[model samples]
Target chain A: MKNKLLFSLITFTTLFIMSCKQDLNDLSNETNNASNVKLVGLGIMEISYDMKTIRDYETDFSILSELDLSSVNPSEEKQHVEMVLLESGQLNLTITELNFDKKINIPHEILPDDSPKIMKTEIIGNTANFYDINGKLLGSENIPIPNHRETVDKIKEIGNKFSAEDINKTIATMQGYQFIDNLEEFIRNAPANGVQVLEQGENYVSLRMSFNKIDPRIQGASVLLIDKSINKMVGTRIYDAQDNLVQSVFFGYNKGDVQSLSAIRIEQQTHLPSGSEVKMISISQIENLKFNLNIK
Target chain B: MKNTIFKLVSFFVLFLFAQNILAQRNVAWVHGLDGDAGSWQHYNAIFDAERNINSLRTSYNTDNGITHASNQVKNSMDTFYGSNANNPLNLGIGHSMGGLMIRDVDRLTPSTNKRFGGYVTVTSPNYGAPIANSLMDGSVQNAAANACNKLNDGPLSEIFSLPYGITANLTTNVLCNKFISNDLVQDMIGTPITNYDLRVGSPTIEALKNHTNNSNIPRISIWAQESSPVHWRMFSSSEFNNDQTLVNYVNDAREIYNVFFMLNTSLAMACGVGGFWFPPCWAASALYTYRATQWYKGRSWIDDSENIWNSLIKTTRSEQQTYWAYIWIPCSYPPSLVEEKNPNPNCGQWEWREFTRWVSVNYPSDGLLPKYTQELQNIPTGNRYYVPGANHLEVRNMSNSTLNGQPNDVTKARFNEIFNRPQGDWFRTN
Candidate 1:
């Protein structure tokens, strides 16, 4: 049984390796062809965000200061109103209609006769301490209490409305999105000495070109590995100044109709070591670097 | 044998040393809002010489917002440096929301090993942009609809869809929600947003205000001011607004959106306008005029140490007016020949000359973020480099020194200096 499994694994590895090489060779051939194309629509997406502390309202404190603390005994256990500010806001200060004392849990339904008082309450660095009618130390409520029920409900509503599948679908369609209307002009105005054809075959051609200048943290690389076995362009590799492999980027893109004179699609991925990646779908008319050719 | 062994070991040591010298530090470029990795396309050459620069792309899907983006950045750092407690030394350069992303990185992954040598914010609206109000209040959406209709009448219909995708984003009120909800975005809610909203009721902004940065990492801010008088309308020009593209590929609404400073806390304080409402519109406008004409406070970075660095670029409105008059006005005419009443006062109406004066004394900004917004009260200053006449996007272009017919060597060198320094050593005065 072991021998059979080993044999099967070896065979699978060999087949997988062969298929990858065949795909790369085919792509090399396809790009190497001396195809005249114009640079038209290019879509480069930049994804970034800033992190800030998200405040939850549930555990917030409503300051009810100046407790009476005039009657209870020091030894006897007594209850008092302890408020915590879960989130800083204009909290409608409400006290229980009947001030019962084991421990007052903040109610969600605020009554109209509650007489909403106002105070600039803070959740940081300060806490609320409750005492009995007689001066006895009760528990203290700290700032930044867990989010309120209403706040949690709102978050849930937002979460329910948010569909990862919808988002992913939108992003996938945009990944290979193209604008091939003005390919010729973009290529004509591209930086000079930007393209160098490397290899070619009967039906294909491959070329190396400088898309844009990126900073020097990366050095040493030889060629761009373009994997096009799938419908969209996915990953690309960059070498350092010394022609040694250093970075690899995995992304997504849409291909333009290369057969027709109408448009061309190219997928380029730029990788940041910070794990951020950009998959660009550049669709244009014709193809590759604009070489001198007849326009039909 | 002993001598040979010593020589071999010495050779190995020397080789490693040489490799270290040649290897450059890693640079992560966090782009602005609605920006993908391509946003940093212009500044590529700046670090190509010695540093490896990675452009971090943020998600456009508003649902994820900054919270999700922060997680992505942390994951990227972990992946880049390997999952270990030891993080490689790197410099983080963020523009606009990108800077806030860095702050978010620090917030989310406080324990992560990725050590930032230094952080540089170029024209970052650490405080929220007032234009976000116009966007949220439906003014910008209305304008975009108007602009799209106008553009469609011309050749714009052939290339761009009427009410472009970005315009629709603004109109739908989705993209603005992603921003207004973010805590970092909340930090920048100035001007139009009432003081009650900014101070008493805003939980996120209030939390941010009280939150302290315990780390000792150095932060350097590079801001630009218009050398000449720049009209607000000039921001709509192709050079500053659209990157000279045939189609509107990026959202440049923040540039031209009218920012009403009536509710600005500082301006209110300056004008002595009080209360939740009924501050007297004329009084508020007079205060705004005074604030705009006078040398108002600019951006400052205050760390836990209580250290502060004021804006280095300072040119009074009077000085800027004089310079504009000297260049555009005839030698015989008075400098104030064109008063504020004239639409073309200070020659600001002309888009061709507007680029030269993208920032000015009255409106100190890099044609995107205002200079005054950088100068919040009570924040400790770290390091500041001020460059007048520098556009917002071009602030990161270090290489080529001179491009777009402008000399950027001074600002470029300043950027290089901050990046080249070791962690905790940059922007030190003592």
Candidate 2:
């Protein structure tokens, strides 16, 4: 009877050990799956701009107009923006070295100058961490990530299957058509009869493209000046329904094997109610532009 | 064969009993100011549901100083645990001033092998409570005393026909007792010694700061902020509504009296003009004059009623404003993010910007204590849990609907999370 009891105890001990081993194995597999997720590339750029916004409120009475006139002084600031596109379709942006002419005050005891200068986002965690100028972590916030799981899957699939050029195209598309890439597609997709060559130079061609066919609400057209030699858009002008020049963007490119934007200037004019008009002009200079960077 | 079976069953039972004895855990529930062992009756049931855990509801004199109260708690703990009074596995859970008492108990005891394995403070005023400061300054008590005096001697006395005599004394004794019994008034007039110890910058608080929990014992703080407005009873009571209605009726009576006065004045003037030759006209003028004088006197009485009503309304409104300011604050954002006035043309009539500027400040508090005071700097941020919209009492009661943005059971869940307990094992030993 004692021997039989010993055998039962041995069997129970062995089963418990086996179950524990299975749990350890399962934990390791989960860790391995987590390790497979990686950041594919990162884009680093320094943006410095001096923006002046003047708002003029015109009224029938001169006294009323004078009282309503509100304008913001020209403010100069500089920031370093890093865009990290993960292999899991997670895009994170970190802004550092954010300098302003004056300290900006945010509500609830956190002032912009005292707050963390380096702000970064963790895609998988759906959270953002803020660090001071010396890289000491100050705080973290959980941000809502829409379609998180699906985005991760899509990004992993793209990273695994796409070539370097295709990945660059994807990053550029995500950045928007205004930065770089998709120039051929954009030109091809323009209305057949709406595109008209406005001017032609030795190295550049200016084309006027109307967007009436694409969307009826957009009663506007864009005039793009592209460098014919490099097939890169250098400048663009957008007009409103009343044929008023609303926005103008000028892009400067680096002289390198890979065409990259070095500087950009944007000017915008908006008309508000009460006969108010606002004009803003800003110049952003970018540096350290890299493509297909392997980010850890 | 029967002997073998009986011996095996005895051995199994003994092993299980030994396991239970080894796994025994004790949690002492400490109450705050003016509270007793009964204060934890609700939480006692919660902890009782856990296996191998004993709940010790400590009874102490909360009216005295924190040190004295802590001594009482120590005695109770010693009596309950007996030989294991200084057990390192004992846990302490305190609310409000009881938290300070528990800390005092720890401080008085030897540091090595401390009495508490861990400590959890719920809505404890670590840095002291502002209300305590107000009480110590005699402002809250003065307000209550003044209110009581007014109820005894002011317009209320005249209205009830008890004017400066035995009846007035009787009315004062009865009515003032009722006024003093009001929950708000009673809380404001808390015991002096406890209030002094609970005030900010008190010697006890400074001592606690100096001796902070340097031991390796784990500490957790569970604090809440009261986001909801003050209860209606605090500012607008049924008595106030009735008084306002009385004022409106008095104003209506005054208007009627004024009409009669005007009509009587016109008749007196006509009679006086004809009284130069007629005796009946002279009598008629005299009668009209007397009637007008009486109506004017009645109008003056109505004016007195209006004045009293205005005074009461002013006092109540001031109290309401004070209560409102205590729980809420104006927006503190910069001009760029928020404007002083709405700039939208379509909604120019709306005061949305002004409303936001005045009411949008969601400062964290636990009704009685602010977040800053409730959170102990010694405790790590990870260990401190905040439940927004849960007031001081509601946090411990664990019945606040707005606690952690969930209806009922959230407080228990939060407490379980703080204790690192799995579901259905809040106090169970693994």
Candidate 3:
């Protein structure tokens, strides 16, 4: 009877240890699943880059005219920024340095001598803390968190839900563009979303896409020129519904990494009340870009 | 017979020269909002001094729309010059909203029969006054009054509570009450129809913007910056000094309290040295202690009063700075300087700090209309003249002492300069 009792007790102890191990395994699985879900939510984990933006203005009015903003020399600004997306759906942005080429007279009282050299945002707490280069907290402000994740998700959901044919058709109807092909076949065989191929070359393809469908307020369409070898969009021309060219954008790619963007140039025109037009051109150059970085 | 023929020919030539030189240049001086014909009384006198120039001060209901005022100006010009109303020598010189009215008049006048050879705008809200926007919304005045009240009866009252009645009287009677009773602040409280026309982004101003002025017609704009210290007191009377008497009293009381505290300490030291054994010495020590305690409390009151007084001055200065004109631009980061409700977050926010006024761009103003808006669009930069150290009303007819060796009356000088120029047919002989 004593041998039998000892064997039963040993069996019970073994069962209890196995049940605890199963619970541990289940908890581990849950953690992994949660991490995977977060990864899916944030497609790009982190990005750190230094950006230089140059803005130029051109106007039909006389350069000396106060209304002609072009009289002021083009403004160039450089900044280093690092952004990180956490599993909790919070985005953190750290700006190390920002400098302007033009002489800007900022008040010492407003932007004091002890002003932060490095600024960082804690989105979870909705606070932006300013720090010196030595990482000493100079000041803090309670600000509204920018809904970066939600905005990105909404954009992605819209992109995934709509096919190229449906978007193009909707855009065409709104912008008064006509499609020559039958609607059913066009919907079925369209390769790119919201884009219609205008011409195809050996090394390049020209395509037209409507911006009006995406933003109903913007009554314009964009014509894109893609470089086939690099598989990158190189140039774009934006035209109003009246076929007037309103803006143009050009892109340059990194030589080492064909997929990475190096520089972008955008020129935009705005019509003024005095039957004159003001054109603003901006060029942005990117450097030292690190993708999916662990920024803490 | 030959001498008589030569004399006849010379007389005919001389007569034609006189006609060209002495031709009557008719000028219609128009007034601004809530103004009358008398607005141009001093200006007209100066214009009258010029030879062969006819000055007519035009009066109209400025409370009416700009179009109605423009019609009145046109009718006045017609009556003043009669058959020669459409003469190219006719000129319009307008002040404030009068400038906009003249522009409307030009718009209404047919190009073939140009009523004005040229026009001049003096301290005009050509684009529109930001103050008009504030006045219409009743924000600036209300804000000033609210700030004054808060300083008098809010947290400041509690801070000055130790001094009690005197500090209370100083805040309510001298500082805030005087500020609230300021003429400019009182004037800003009334909302009139003209305020709509004078406001920035108003439909009337938009329409004027859409209708560009005829570039062929010569025009000049005169703007000024307020130099007088009195003008800077937008929310307070000129008599409002820094209340030095109260400051002096507080300083004196603090000194007295220090002396008393030292004396009490000495007495306590004496009592500790066996003076406590005598009843008389003990009673004297207790009385001194009570007196020292009272003086110490008084010292605290003095310190609090000083803080409250400094705060009051700071708050008043801040209020004055808000009403002062400044050129603003978009700014990024350093959020303290930015105005409320940032329109463009991508570029930055609107900067409205007082220091920005001096550092960014000093767009000299007439204590009312900025030089930017005073300048009519498409008007040549050469024609715009800035009168430094002159206020809004001063730009009208008041003399600016800083115009070295030139005529002190900036309005008259600018007018003479425009009319006396040889390019236009309205050229004056003297």
Candidate 4:
């Protein structure tokens, strides 16, 4: 009992000293208790396992970035599971080498004829932002086009990796790489240091990109890095057979309240000039989402 | 019968409890230079003389002899300091040189800070060995002491004196020469750093020297002596009447304890700091220093050299008797001095109560110097005292030299004095 009391006193003194030495009390950005408390889920899809504790510290540092080491062990016997959170008012999905393997069940129906259907509905208050399709914002401001240095590099590199053989008779006739230069022009580089920009607000952006034709080989890989803390598309990288990030995308966000809320949606279309007809193929959406809000 | 069974079970439980408490402590022993660690048999004899304290793993940090026997002592200490500090022996018993080694190890390495639970020293000159200078100049026979402090010419002298004689001749010459000639010694030891020099950087020694004698670690110094000069001390002294042998080691301890007692007596500041409290003088520091200089002077060197290197370094080290200048010496002078004292039997020369701070027996007064002579008659500080039948070496290590000398059915009283076997009656003297 005596020892415990003395220990408590000592611990108190140590804690007091530490607090006196540091200045870390940020009160500027406060959130409601419920808003700050993050929620983790796979949206509507329920995973078989829910591990409360993980071995992320044992995570492979082999990669410079912190990759979740939660049983990502390549061993066949152990089930590989990636845990993610679906926060309130938000549903985000990220996949891995497993990206192409699994598809999200789309709730929306598709048209039987594979004809181009253009939908132009601005995101009302803010056009949100046009990302490089890999999910990264093109720029801080939603311009008519993405900041293009990355788009050009990615498009060109992806073009070079395609083999004539992979470019089947079906895809050869399609207009795919024809607009590659135009896509390249969309990826603009970070502004020069001394250049002054008077505005730092959302600029409605519009993007029109489609793979009118794809090589038959189906060999390409890409990854997107999202900055969840600030709700921004930090970067996106694309690699071909050469295994280089031949393409990249960058973007940023600003702090605002729920009143200035936002959202993002993605769509993918792969067009191949298959037989005589454009193959009036009907393909359902590989992903979907649902949200119901009752604001007080 | 049922009660007896209950008692037995209770007894076993108590034994287990005792083991647990004891095991919680990590222990190690240290020794001063010149004393043979190889002489546990001798240590037994000394323990018997002073009252036995079985604690082992003694250390002796300084001295050419330690350097000579570094490999051996290091191995012994490694076995003792423990592979891990977590589990320790709990009790450490060191003699003259072994005691210094313990202090040094504690000073240099993390042997034990708050960890050590207890300490037992049998006649340790924690300040230093008198014959250090002589030992440096090819005089003292303790090879281990010389080897431990390969270079004792100058800064090393601060620890204590360098006593010289025939025994130190060949070894000192060879070791000193080898040390000086070596490029490594010149480079590595360009400067000699003393314990005082270390007091600034190292906290334990600083605490040992500064704070309460000891706060968390409980410690006891069992000072004992044999005034009768050993065969080697007699032959080593150039001044026929001025020699102190291994037996006089008690007096050196007397000085160290005096300081500790003084600082402890000062009161207020020094309490519960290091672990152990100074026995009598609660306020000894305001009153005295924690790790007192103890003795004012150690033995001197008698130069007998014609060669330059021999004359400069070797001769000066051998001939100087540094002990005379010590503050405690003159004040605690002879006949009139003992009477001038507080008359407390426990009071040593420094007015610090002697009670086990230092103790000596059977002075060889006739042929020895006055300091040694006085030590023989110095009232034993510890009320409890024990003696075994043997000479210096034999008394130091209780082991029998010849088969006849070995373990001759020591009386329970004698065994108690020697081992201080906690559970047994061994600690009867304490």
Model 3 C-alpha lDDT per residue in residues A114-182, reported as the tens digit of each score: 112333222222334454456565444332222234323322332454454543433222111122122
Off by over 4 Å in 2: A1-296, B142-190, B231-362, B400-406, B421-430
Lowest summed-lDDT stretch of 10 residues in model 3 chain B? Answer: B313-322
Fnat per candidate, as a fraction, reads 0.00, 0.00, 0.01, 0.00
- Over B240-323, each residue of candidate 4 has an lDDT whose tens digit, in order, gives 222233213222222222222222111111111100111111111111121111111111011001111121111111111111
Work out how many backbone clashes candidate 1 has.
79
Candidate 3 - CAPRI tier? Answer: incorrect
| Distance from true location, Cα of A288 in model 4, Å | 99
Instruction: Mark the 10 consecutive residues where model 1 chain B has the least summed lDDT.
Output: B300-309
By TM-score, how accurate is candidate 1?
0.33
Where does candidate 3 stray beyond 4 Å?
A: A1-296, B1-22, B150-191, B213-215, B228-363, B400-408, B423-430
User: Which should have the higher TM-score, number 1 or number 3?
Assistant: 3
Top candidate on lDDT is: 3
**iRMS of each prediction in angstroms?**
32.0, 38.6, 32.3, 45.1
Name the lDDT value of residue A137 in candidate 3.
58
lDDT of 4 at B214: 37
Per-residue CA lDDT of candidate 3, range B111-214, in tens? 98777877888778888776666555544434345334333322221121312333334434343343334333343334366667767898888777766553
Two-chain DockQ for each candidate model: 0.01, 0.00, 0.01, 0.00
